[model samples]
Target: MKPFWIYYQKEMLEASRTYKWIWVPAVFLLLGIMQPVSTYYLPEILTMSGEVPPEAAALFTIPSADSVMASTLSQFSTIGLLVLVLAGMNTVAGERATGTAELVLTRTVSTLPMMGAKWAAMMTLMLVSFALGLAGAAYYTHQLIGPLEWGAVASGGLLYAVWLAWIVTLVLPLGAVLRGPAAAFISLGTAAALSLLSGLLPSRFQWSPGRLSSMAAEWMLGAGAGAWAPVIAALLIMLLSIIAAAGLLRRSPLSPQS
Candidate 1:
């Protein structure tokens, strides 16, 4: 077996033992429950806000209750992708910051394997969290909102997760490049900025991961056909990001103090 495989197993075991591991799935499950429930009730809440004058009410075409729920899920997922950044930001930088990298290096561990192990562990955690969240959301939405076109929702959600994962993959390089949690902070800033900037690009270039981050939730809310291009692009980017992150880790300077 490869050393990185062993290292990956160790990292996962450590993460599982930690208390915070429970929160990742728990919070996502809460979002799943809240999103649909809130969507169903939002119209009533708005109506209770007090009857607008006839003229104002006439101009406002209230969206359907189902649309409201979809919008809530979409919005939540957009912000929630940041959870990836938070989960990964310290994947590597924390080890270096605490001088653990030196200890790991002392064991005859190659740089590539160490980095590879960390990346694998982080990606595994990410994939599991995303799957759990999507499963919960899909189940609750189906139960509460009546029958949905799950094929559309599943494809959209999976694609969006892929895009977000690519965006998160940058955190590994950032963590390797910077010390401490600064990498995570930079990853957050980069994801947010890229999401905003994609809007300015031409539609031809819009299928990139950056655009996916901004519009994924909208697609989940039923943007219709042709959105699959970006979805496919996002998956491609996820693969590319992992390769790029590994290469970057391999090239980072070794600690002289070690």
Candidate 2:
């Protein structure tokens, strides 16, 4: 237990030194704030370009606050997700690439605690960044769009965070064997495929973690009923990812040089 906290602290310090703690949260906050700001200013923006007719501009209406907040989550779903995956892609892989893992593994009895610490540190960053982003989106939505239900926002944000967690967790095990970029690419590809499959076959993929983004939106809109399946599935997947990462690390603590 003490070792776990030590590893976790090390990971946090590493993140700070790498400037990840700053840029990742900044990106999320920017993405979140931009959604509502852009949506609110769309009519004027289009008019300034002279490409939109007055009648067309008049037809534009601000969406509901809930809808704007949901759109903010969608923003996180794309670029925000990409940023997070890229930031975490090298976590384990870099250590191995630099021979840091070899040193760490020699001092540890099992790789599980180290892996767990890495995952926890990643989650800490994710949660703090997401919360800031969500808060910014909610504030702008309230000021520019309409009032929002704080309860719904909190619940929906948790669901969305869970969705992001599983996808980000993929880099752990993947990085154990693959290069950093390869791990990130495959993690993103897997997320894309799952999202596409879930969209195409809603009934079949009801328990899919990919459905979490939409479920989050629905929950924010006050229509997310019976969404426990995907939430549970996502949590299970994260656990499995950690365990797999530990085993993979135990087997191959250092990455093969190119």
Candidate 3:
């Protein structure tokens, strides 16, 4: 347990030194705030660009508050997720590739605690970044657009965060076995494929974690998210990711790719 905290602190310090703690949240806040601002000024923006006629500009309608907030979340679903995944892609792979893992494994009593600490640090960063981004988005949406149901925003944010955590968790195991960029690409690719499949087969893939993104938008829009299956499925996947990574780290501390 003590080792876990020690390792966790090291991971966080590294992130801080790298300015991840600053820029990541800042990016999320920017993404969130931009949604409502851009939507609210769409006509002005179009007019300034001179790409649209006055008649066409007049036809543009500002989305409702809830719709804008939902769209803000959608921004996280794509670019936000990409940024996080790329940032986390080297968590484990870098250690192994640089021979840092060899030193840590020698000093630590075992791999489980070290790996658990790594996972916890990653989870903390993801949650904090997402929460900040969501808060920023929600605030701008309310001020620029309209009132939002606080309950819906909280619930929807949790649901969306879960989906994100699950995707980011892939970095641990994938980074353990693959090179850094390969892990990032494969993780994002897997997430995209799952999201696409869930969208195409909503009825058949009701329990898919990918559906959580859509369900989160529905929640933000004051819609019932139906079953808790997606949340449960996401949790299960996250647990599996930890187990898989821990097992892999235990078995192949020196040669992760093997």
Best TM-score among the predictions, by candidate number:
2
| Candidates, ranked, TM-score | 2, 3, 1
Q: Candidate 3, 63: how far from true, in Å? A: 0.5
Against the hidden reference, what TM-scores do the models get? Answer: 0.78, 0.98, 0.95
- Residue 245 of model 1 has an lDDT of 55
Q: Candidate 1: TM-score?
A: 0.78
Which pairs clash in model 3? none
- Candidates ranked by lDDT: 2, 3, 1
Report lDDT (CA) for all predictions: 0.63, 0.93, 0.86
List, residue by residue over 158-231, the lDDT tens digit for candidate 1. Answer: 65666666667777667666864677777767766766667766464666566664465655667744556666
lDDT of 2 by residue, 1-258 (tens): 988999999999999999999999999999999999999999999899998898999999889999999989999999999999999999988988888898889998899999999999999999999999999999999999899999999999999999999999999999999989999999999999999999999999989988998889999998977878988998998999999999998998987872
State the weakest 10-residue window (summed lDDT) of model 3.
249-258
* Model 2 segments more than 4 A misplaced: none
Evaluate model 3: give its TM-score.
0.95
The residue-by-residue lDDT of candidate 3 on 1-258, one tens digit each, is 898889999999999999989888888888888998899999999988997998899999999998888888899988899889988988888887887788778786677677778878888888888888888888888888789899999988988899899899988888778888999999989889999999998888989888888888998889965748888888888888878887887677765353
Number of colliding residue pairs in each model: 0, 0, 0
lDDT of 2 at 184: 98
